[model samples]
Target: MLDLYDRRIVASLNSKYIDSKLAIDTLALALKKHSPKPGLLLHSDQGSQFASQEFTAYCKENAIVQSMSRAGCPYDNAAMERFYNTFKNEYICRYYFKTDEELNLGTQDYVFVWYNYTRPHSYNGGIPPSRVRFR
Candidate 1:
Protein backbone atom coordinates (compact mmCIF):
# COMPACT_ATOMS: atom_id res chain seq x y z
CA MET A 1 0.00 0.00 0.00
CA LEU A 2 2.97 2.32 0.46
CA ASP A 3 3.79 4.48 -2.54
CA LEU A 4 7.43 5.05 -1.69
CA TYR A 5 8.30 8.04 -3.84
CA ASP A 6 4.93 9.76 -3.68
CA ARG A 7 4.66 9.12 0.03
CA ARG A 8 1.03 8.22 -0.55
CA ILE A 9 -0.88 5.01 -0.59
CA VAL A 10 -1.02 3.26 -3.92
CA ALA A 11 -3.64 0.63 -3.21
CA SER A 12 -5.10 -1.46 -0.44
CA LEU A 13 -7.39 -4.45 -0.19
CA ASN A 14 -8.85 -6.45 2.66
CA SER A 15 -7.87 -10.04 2.17
CA LYS A 16 -6.00 -12.55 4.25
CA TYR A 17 -5.99 -14.62 1.09
CA ILE A 18 -2.86 -12.86 -0.22
CA ASP A 19 0.40 -14.65 0.38
CA SER A 20 3.79 -13.09 0.92
CA LYS A 21 5.04 -14.12 -2.48
CA LEU A 22 2.05 -12.63 -4.23
CA ALA A 23 2.41 -9.41 -2.26
CA ILE A 24 6.03 -9.21 -3.23
CA ASP A 25 5.24 -9.79 -6.89
CA THR A 26 2.47 -7.24 -6.82
CA LEU A 27 4.81 -4.65 -5.30
CA ALA A 28 7.40 -5.35 -7.93
CA LEU A 29 4.83 -4.81 -10.64
CA ALA A 30 3.62 -1.54 -9.17
CA LEU A 31 7.16 -0.31 -8.69
CA LYS A 32 7.89 -1.11 -12.28
CA LYS A 33 5.32 1.43 -13.42
CA HIS A 34 6.06 4.10 -10.82
CA SER A 35 9.74 3.66 -10.21
CA PRO A 36 11.77 2.36 -13.09
CA LYS A 37 15.10 3.80 -11.99
CA PRO A 38 15.44 1.27 -9.18
CA GLY A 39 17.88 1.95 -6.32
CA LEU A 40 15.03 3.41 -4.32
CA LEU A 41 14.94 2.82 -0.61
CA LEU A 42 12.19 0.43 0.34
CA HIS A 43 11.76 0.62 4.08
CA SER A 44 9.63 -1.95 5.79
CA ASP A 45 9.27 -3.83 9.02
CA GLN A 46 10.42 -7.43 9.25
CA GLY A 47 7.07 -8.91 8.50
CA SER A 48 7.02 -12.18 6.64
CA GLN A 49 5.73 -10.30 3.61
CA PHE A 50 8.74 -8.07 3.56
CA ALA A 51 11.22 -10.71 4.61
CA SER A 52 10.15 -13.41 2.23
CA GLN A 53 12.91 -14.76 0.02
CA GLU A 54 11.10 -13.64 -3.10
CA PHE A 55 10.87 -10.08 -1.85
CA THR A 56 14.49 -9.97 -0.81
CA ALA A 57 15.55 -11.36 -4.12
CA TYR A 58 13.42 -8.88 -5.98
CA CYS A 59 15.02 -5.99 -4.15
CA LYS A 60 18.45 -7.36 -4.83
CA GLU A 61 17.73 -7.92 -8.47
CA ASN A 62 16.20 -4.51 -8.91
CA ALA A 63 19.05 -2.69 -7.15
CA ILE A 64 16.75 -1.44 -4.44
CA VAL A 65 17.97 -0.95 -0.92
CA GLN A 66 15.79 -2.83 1.50
CA SER A 67 15.77 -1.27 4.92
CA MET A 68 14.21 -3.11 7.80
CA SER A 69 13.15 -1.44 10.97
CA ARG A 70 14.32 -2.82 14.24
CA ALA A 71 12.05 -5.21 16.04
CA GLY A 72 9.69 -3.86 18.73
CA CYS A 73 9.89 -0.27 17.55
CA PRO A 74 6.59 1.07 16.37
CA TYR A 75 8.06 4.46 15.55
CA ASP A 76 10.41 2.87 13.10
CA ASN A 77 7.50 2.44 10.69
CA ALA A 78 5.35 5.33 11.78
CA ALA A 79 4.19 6.30 8.29
CA MET A 80 2.79 2.92 7.38
CA GLU A 81 1.28 2.52 10.83
CA ARG A 82 -0.43 5.86 10.52
CA PHE A 83 -1.67 4.94 7.06
CA TYR A 84 -3.26 1.74 8.32
CA ASN A 85 -4.89 3.58 11.19
CA THR A 86 -6.37 6.13 8.82
CA PHE A 87 -7.54 3.43 6.44
CA LYS A 88 -9.25 1.53 9.21
CA ASN A 89 -10.82 4.60 10.70
CA GLU A 90 -12.07 6.12 7.49
CA TYR A 91 -13.26 2.98 5.69
CA ILE A 92 -13.07 -0.24 7.63
CA CYS A 93 -14.51 1.18 10.83
CA ARG A 94 -17.71 2.31 9.14
CA TYR A 95 -18.45 -0.79 7.14
CA TYR A 96 -19.61 -4.21 8.25
CA PHE A 97 -18.46 -6.44 5.45
CA LYS A 98 -20.40 -9.70 5.34
CA THR A 99 -17.83 -11.54 3.30
CA ASP A 100 -14.22 -11.38 2.18
CA GLU A 101 -15.33 -10.53 -1.35
CA GLU A 102 -17.26 -7.54 -0.12
CA LEU A 103 -14.38 -6.23 1.99
CA ASN A 104 -11.97 -6.76 -0.86
CA LEU A 105 -14.07 -4.90 -3.38
CA GLY A 106 -14.89 -2.07 -1.02
CA THR A 107 -11.32 -1.55 0.06
CA GLN A 108 -10.08 -1.67 -3.51
CA ASP A 109 -12.59 0.93 -4.54
CA TYR A 110 -11.74 3.23 -1.66
CA VAL A 111 -7.98 3.05 -1.89
CA PHE A 112 -7.56 2.90 -5.66
CA VAL A 113 -10.23 5.02 -7.35
CA TRP A 114 -11.69 7.21 -4.62
CA TYR A 115 -8.67 7.84 -2.43
CA ASN A 116 -6.35 8.29 -5.37
CA TYR A 117 -8.58 10.45 -7.52
CA THR A 118 -11.08 12.19 -5.28
CA ARG A 119 -10.01 12.41 -1.66
CA PRO A 120 -7.91 15.45 -0.87
CA HIS A 121 -4.92 14.70 1.29
CA SER A 122 -3.81 17.30 3.79
CA TYR A 123 -0.28 16.00 3.73
CA ASN A 124 -0.02 16.57 -0.01
CA GLY A 125 -1.13 20.17 0.03
CA GLY A 126 -4.80 19.21 0.07
CA ILE A 127 -4.66 17.61 -3.33
CA PRO A 128 -5.81 14.12 -4.18
CA PRO A 129 -3.11 11.51 -4.76
CA SER A 130 -3.85 11.44 -8.46
CA ARG A 131 -3.54 15.17 -8.78
CA VAL A 132 -0.31 15.21 -6.88
CA ARG A 133 1.10 12.61 -9.19
CA PHE A 134 -0.17 13.89 -12.51
CA ARG A 135 -0.28 17.63 -12.02
Candidate 2:
Protein backbone atom coordinates (compact mmCIF):
# COMPACT_ATOMS: atom_id res chain seq x y z
CA MET A 1 0.00 0.00 0.00
CA LEU A 2 1.24 3.51 -0.80
CA ASP A 3 0.98 6.25 1.76
CA LEU A 4 -0.34 9.33 -0.02
CA TYR A 5 1.11 11.87 2.34
CA ASP A 6 4.73 11.14 1.42
CA ARG A 7 4.38 8.86 -1.60
CA ARG A 8 5.95 6.07 0.41
CA ILE A 9 5.12 2.44 -0.09
CA VAL A 10 3.98 1.53 3.39
CA ALA A 11 3.52 -2.14 2.57
CA SER A 12 3.65 -4.61 -0.26
CA LEU A 13 3.55 -8.33 -0.98
CA ASN A 14 4.21 -10.61 -3.90
CA SER A 15 2.02 -13.59 -4.60
CA LYS A 16 0.83 -15.72 -7.45
CA TYR A 17 -2.75 -14.94 -6.54
CA ILE A 18 -4.48 -11.65 -6.00
CA ASP A 19 -6.93 -12.86 -3.41
CA SER A 20 -8.24 -11.64 -0.10
CA LYS A 21 -5.42 -13.32 1.75
CA LEU A 22 -2.81 -11.30 -0.07
CA ALA A 23 -4.72 -8.10 0.50
CA ILE A 24 -5.18 -8.78 4.19
CA ASP A 25 -1.57 -9.79 4.65
CA THR A 26 -0.28 -6.65 2.98
CA LEU A 27 -2.56 -4.49 5.10
CA ALA A 28 -1.41 -6.31 8.19
CA LEU A 29 2.19 -5.53 7.31
CA ALA A 30 1.40 -1.86 6.95
CA LEU A 31 -0.45 -1.84 10.25
CA LYS A 32 2.44 -3.50 12.02
CA LYS A 33 4.96 -1.08 10.58
CA HIS A 34 2.97 2.06 11.30
CA SER A 35 0.19 1.95 13.80
CA PRO A 36 -2.02 4.64 12.45
CA LYS A 37 -4.92 5.79 14.57
CA PRO A 38 -8.44 4.61 13.93
CA GLY A 39 -10.52 5.91 11.04
CA LEU A 40 -7.65 5.68 8.55
CA LEU A 41 -8.93 5.90 5.01
CA LEU A 42 -7.74 3.10 2.74
CA HIS A 43 -8.34 3.92 -0.89
CA SER A 44 -8.08 1.08 -3.36
CA ASP A 45 -9.35 -0.13 -6.69
CA GLN A 46 -12.68 -1.93 -6.80
CA GLY A 47 -11.05 -5.31 -6.93
CA SER A 48 -12.83 -8.34 -5.55
CA GLN A 49 -9.99 -8.93 -3.14
CA PHE A 50 -10.44 -5.55 -1.59
CA ALA A 51 -14.23 -6.00 -1.44
CA SER A 52 -14.14 -9.56 -0.13
CA GLN A 53 -15.87 -10.28 3.15
CA GLU A 54 -12.67 -11.23 4.93
CA PHE A 55 -10.83 -8.13 3.83
CA THR A 56 -13.73 -5.90 4.72
CA ALA A 57 -14.01 -7.43 8.15
CA TYR A 58 -10.30 -7.09 8.70
CA CYS A 59 -10.45 -3.38 7.90
CA LYS A 60 -13.40 -2.85 10.21
CA GLU A 61 -11.64 -4.72 13.00
CA ASN A 62 -8.74 -2.35 12.61
CA ALA A 63 -10.99 0.70 12.41
CA ILE A 64 -9.95 1.42 8.86
CA VAL A 65 -12.37 3.03 6.44
CA GLN A 66 -12.22 1.44 3.01
CA SER A 67 -12.90 3.52 -0.06
CA MET A 68 -13.14 2.10 -3.54
CA SER A 69 -12.48 3.93 -6.72
CA ARG A 70 -15.36 4.52 -9.11
CA ALA A 71 -15.90 1.62 -11.44
CA GLY A 72 -13.53 1.60 -14.45
CA CYS A 73 -12.11 4.96 -13.36
CA PRO A 74 -8.37 4.70 -12.88
CA TYR A 75 -8.15 8.39 -12.12
CA ASP A 76 -9.69 7.83 -8.73
CA ASN A 77 -6.63 5.90 -7.68
CA ALA A 78 -4.06 7.70 -9.81
CA ALA A 79 -1.29 7.71 -7.27
CA MET A 80 -1.28 3.95 -6.97
CA GLU A 81 -1.45 3.59 -10.72
CA ARG A 82 1.42 5.95 -11.15
CA PHE A 83 3.45 4.13 -8.55
CA TYR A 84 2.87 0.80 -10.26
CA ASN A 85 3.84 2.25 -13.58
CA THR A 86 7.02 3.70 -12.20
CA PHE A 87 7.90 0.51 -10.40
CA LYS A 88 7.33 -1.61 -13.47
CA ASN A 89 9.21 0.60 -15.82
CA GLU A 90 12.01 1.62 -13.52
CA TYR A 91 12.71 -1.61 -11.68
CA ILE A 92 10.72 -4.76 -12.46
CA CYS A 93 11.01 -4.56 -16.21
CA ARG A 94 14.74 -4.08 -16.07
CA TYR A 95 15.52 -7.47 -14.54
CA TYR A 96 14.44 -11.04 -14.94
CA PHE A 97 14.05 -12.82 -11.63
CA LYS A 98 15.10 -16.47 -11.43
CA THR A 99 13.15 -17.15 -8.28
CA ASP A 100 10.40 -15.75 -6.08
CA GLU A 101 12.91 -15.19 -3.29
CA GLU A 102 15.10 -13.14 -5.59
CA LEU A 103 12.16 -11.07 -6.70
CA ASN A 104 11.07 -10.47 -3.14
CA LEU A 105 14.54 -9.46 -2.01
CA GLY A 106 14.98 -7.19 -5.03
CA THR A 107 11.63 -5.59 -4.39
CA GLN A 108 12.53 -4.97 -0.75
CA ASP A 109 15.72 -3.25 -1.77
CA TYR A 110 14.01 -1.19 -4.46
CA VAL A 111 11.26 -0.01 -2.15
CA PHE A 112 13.13 0.54 1.09
CA VAL A 113 16.56 1.49 -0.16
CA TRP A 114 16.20 3.10 -3.58
CA TYR A 115 12.68 4.38 -3.87
CA ASN A 116 12.16 5.63 -0.33
CA TYR A 117 15.61 6.95 0.36
CA THR A 118 17.42 7.67 -2.90
CA ARG A 119 14.94 8.38 -5.64
CA PRO A 120 13.58 11.89 -5.91
CA HIS A 121 9.84 12.36 -6.31
CA SER A 122 8.39 15.43 -7.87
CA TYR A 123 5.35 15.41 -5.65
CA ASN A 124 7.60 15.50 -2.62
CA GLY A 125 9.36 18.58 -4.01
CA GLY A 126 12.11 16.56 -5.74
CA ILE A 127 13.23 14.97 -2.49
CA PRO A 128 13.02 11.35 -1.54
CA PRO A 129 9.87 10.09 0.13
CA SER A 130 11.65 9.26 3.37
CA ARG A 131 13.02 12.78 3.54
CA VAL A 132 9.57 14.23 3.07
CA ARG A 133 8.10 11.78 5.54
CA PHE A 134 10.72 12.17 8.25
CA ARG A 135 11.28 15.89 7.86
Candidate 3:
Protein backbone atom coordinates (compact mmCIF):
# COMPACT_ATOMS: atom_id res chain seq x y z
CA MET A 1 0.00 0.00 0.00
CA LEU A 2 1.16 3.52 -0.77
CA ASP A 3 0.93 6.39 1.62
CA LEU A 4 -0.69 9.15 -0.44
CA TYR A 5 1.19 11.87 1.44
CA ASP A 6 4.65 10.81 0.25
CA ARG A 7 3.76 8.01 -2.14
CA ARG A 8 5.89 5.73 -0.04
CA ILE A 9 5.02 2.06 0.05
CA VAL A 10 4.15 1.08 3.58
CA ALA A 11 3.40 -2.56 2.78
CA SER A 12 3.45 -4.97 -0.13
CA LEU A 13 2.10 -8.31 0.93
CA ASN A 14 2.09 -11.19 -1.49
CA SER A 15 0.23 -13.92 0.28
CA LYS A 16 -2.81 -16.11 0.14
CA TYR A 17 -4.56 -14.42 3.06
CA ILE A 18 -3.22 -10.97 3.77
CA ASP A 19 -4.30 -10.80 7.37
CA SER A 20 -3.61 -8.40 10.22
CA LYS A 21 0.12 -9.12 10.12
CA LEU A 22 0.57 -6.93 7.09
CA ALA A 23 -1.54 -4.19 8.59
CA ILE A 24 0.44 -4.25 11.83
CA ASP A 25 3.71 -4.22 9.98
CA THR A 26 2.62 -1.42 7.71
CA LEU A 27 1.33 0.74 10.52
CA ALA A 28 4.53 0.16 12.43
CA LEU A 29 6.67 1.25 9.52
CA ALA A 30 4.54 4.20 8.42
CA LEU A 31 3.93 5.51 11.91
CA LYS A 32 7.47 5.34 13.13
CA LYS A 33 7.72 8.34 15.41
CA HIS A 34 4.95 9.90 13.38
CA SER A 35 1.88 9.12 15.35
CA PRO A 36 -1.12 10.50 13.59
CA LYS A 37 -3.75 12.75 15.16
CA PRO A 38 -7.17 11.43 16.18
CA GLY A 39 -8.81 12.22 12.90
CA LEU A 40 -5.90 11.16 10.71
CA LEU A 41 -7.12 8.88 7.97
CA LEU A 42 -5.65 5.99 6.06
CA HIS A 43 -7.49 5.44 2.86
CA SER A 44 -7.58 2.24 0.82
CA ASP A 45 -9.71 0.11 -1.44
CA GLN A 46 -12.36 -2.12 0.08
CA GLY A 47 -10.05 -5.10 -0.05
CA SER A 48 -10.20 -7.88 2.49
CA GLN A 49 -6.76 -6.94 3.74
CA PHE A 50 -7.96 -3.51 4.76
CA ALA A 51 -11.16 -4.83 6.31
CA SER A 52 -9.80 -7.72 8.32
CA GLN A 53 -10.45 -7.83 12.03
CA GLU A 54 -6.80 -7.35 12.90
CA PHE A 55 -6.54 -4.33 10.63
CA THR A 56 -9.57 -2.80 12.31
CA ALA A 57 -8.08 -3.30 15.74
CA TYR A 58 -4.77 -1.81 14.72
CA CYS A 59 -6.45 1.27 13.28
CA LYS A 60 -8.45 1.68 16.44
CA GLU A 61 -5.34 1.34 18.54
CA ASN A 62 -3.58 3.95 16.48
CA ALA A 63 -6.60 6.24 16.38
CA ILE A 64 -6.47 6.38 12.61
CA VAL A 65 -9.64 6.66 10.60
CA GLN A 66 -9.90 3.99 7.92
CA SER A 67 -11.44 5.21 4.70
CA MET A 68 -12.36 2.72 2.04
CA SER A 69 -13.49 3.24 -1.47
CA ARG A 70 -17.08 2.44 -2.26
CA ALA A 71 -17.85 -1.05 -3.51
CA GLY A 72 -17.43 -1.49 -7.27
CA CYS A 73 -16.26 2.10 -7.61
CA PRO A 74 -12.71 2.54 -8.80
CA TYR A 75 -13.14 6.25 -9.49
CA ASP A 76 -13.37 6.95 -5.78
CA ASN A 77 -9.76 5.75 -5.55
CA ALA A 78 -8.34 7.38 -8.61
CA ALA A 79 -5.01 8.36 -7.11
CA MET A 80 -4.25 4.77 -6.13
CA GLU A 81 -5.35 3.55 -9.51
CA ARG A 82 -2.89 5.97 -11.02
CA PHE A 83 -0.15 4.73 -8.77
CA TYR A 84 -0.75 1.10 -9.74
CA ASN A 85 -1.01 2.00 -13.39
CA THR A 86 2.33 3.70 -13.22
CA PHE A 87 3.79 0.79 -11.35
CA LYS A 88 2.64 -1.73 -13.93
CA ASN A 89 3.41 0.33 -17.01
CA GLU A 90 6.78 1.60 -15.86
CA TYR A 91 8.09 -1.44 -14.05
CA ILE A 92 6.15 -4.71 -14.22
CA CYS A 93 5.17 -4.69 -17.87
CA ARG A 94 8.65 -3.84 -19.09
CA TYR A 95 10.31 -6.91 -17.64
CA TYR A 96 10.29 -10.66 -18.17
CA PHE A 97 10.92 -12.19 -14.81
CA LYS A 98 12.77 -15.51 -14.67
CA THR A 99 12.26 -15.99 -10.97
CA ASP A 100 10.26 -14.75 -8.02
CA GLU A 101 13.40 -13.34 -6.42
CA GLU A 102 14.17 -11.19 -9.45
CA LEU A 103 10.68 -9.70 -9.42
CA ASN A 104 10.78 -9.04 -5.70
CA LEU A 105 14.18 -7.37 -5.86
CA GLY A 106 13.17 -5.32 -8.83
CA THR A 107 10.01 -4.16 -7.10
CA GLN A 108 12.01 -3.26 -3.98
CA ASP A 109 14.42 -1.20 -6.02
CA TYR A 110 11.65 0.54 -7.91
CA VAL A 111 9.73 1.43 -4.78
CA PHE A 112 12.59 2.34 -2.46
CA VAL A 113 15.68 3.57 -4.30
CA TRP A 114 14.03 4.84 -7.44
CA TYR A 115 10.49 5.96 -6.68
CA ASN A 116 11.19 7.37 -3.24
CA TYR A 117 14.73 8.72 -3.42
CA THR A 118 15.44 9.35 -7.09
CA ARG A 119 12.43 9.82 -9.32
CA PRO A 120 10.75 13.20 -9.11
CA HIS A 121 6.96 13.31 -9.30
CA SER A 122 5.19 16.19 -10.98
CA TYR A 123 2.50 16.12 -8.33
CA ASN A 124 5.18 16.58 -5.70
CA GLY A 125 6.43 19.81 -7.26
CA GLY A 126 9.07 17.86 -9.14
CA ILE A 127 10.50 16.47 -5.91
CA PRO A 128 10.99 12.83 -5.04
CA PRO A 129 8.47 11.13 -2.77
CA SER A 130 10.88 11.13 0.16
CA ARG A 131 11.03 14.90 0.10
CA VAL A 132 7.29 15.45 0.26
CA ARG A 133 5.68 16.28 3.57
CA PHE A 134 2.87 14.23 5.11
CA ARG A 135 -0.60 15.50 4.36
Please provide, for model 2 over 18-105, each residue's C-alpha lDDT reduced to its tens digit, 9 standing for 90 to 100: 9999999999999999999999999999999999999999999999999999999979999999999999999999999999999999
Task: Give per-residue lDDT, candidate 1, residue 67.
Answer: 89
What is the TM-score (0 to 1) of candidate 2? Answer: 0.97
Q: Write the per-residue lDDT of candidate 3 for residues 1-135, one digit (tens) a residue.
A: 676776666555443346677666767766774555686788888878789898888888888888999999979788778878888999999999898788878988887788778888887889998888666
Q: How many clashes in each structure?
A: 0, 0, 0
Per-candidate local distance difference test:
0.75, 0.96, 0.77
The C-alpha stretches of model 2 lying farther than 4 A from their native spots are 133-135
- Name model 3 segments beyond 4 Å from true: 16-20, 32-39, 133-135
Candidate closer to the true structure by lDDT (higher is better), 1 or 2: 2
Between candidates 2 and 3, the one scoring higher on TM-score is 2
Candidate 3 weakest lDDT stretch, 10 residues: 10-19
| TM-score per model over all chains | 0.81, 0.97, 0.77
| Candidate 1 CA-lDDT value | 0.75
lDDT per residue as tens, model 1, 82-130? 7788788999999899998888788878877777778887768887767
Rank the candidate models, highest TM-score first: 2, 1, 3
Two-way TM-score contest, 1 vs 3, winner: 1
Candidate 1 has what TM-score? 0.81
Q: How far in Å is the alpha carbon of 64 misplaced in model 3?
A: 2.0
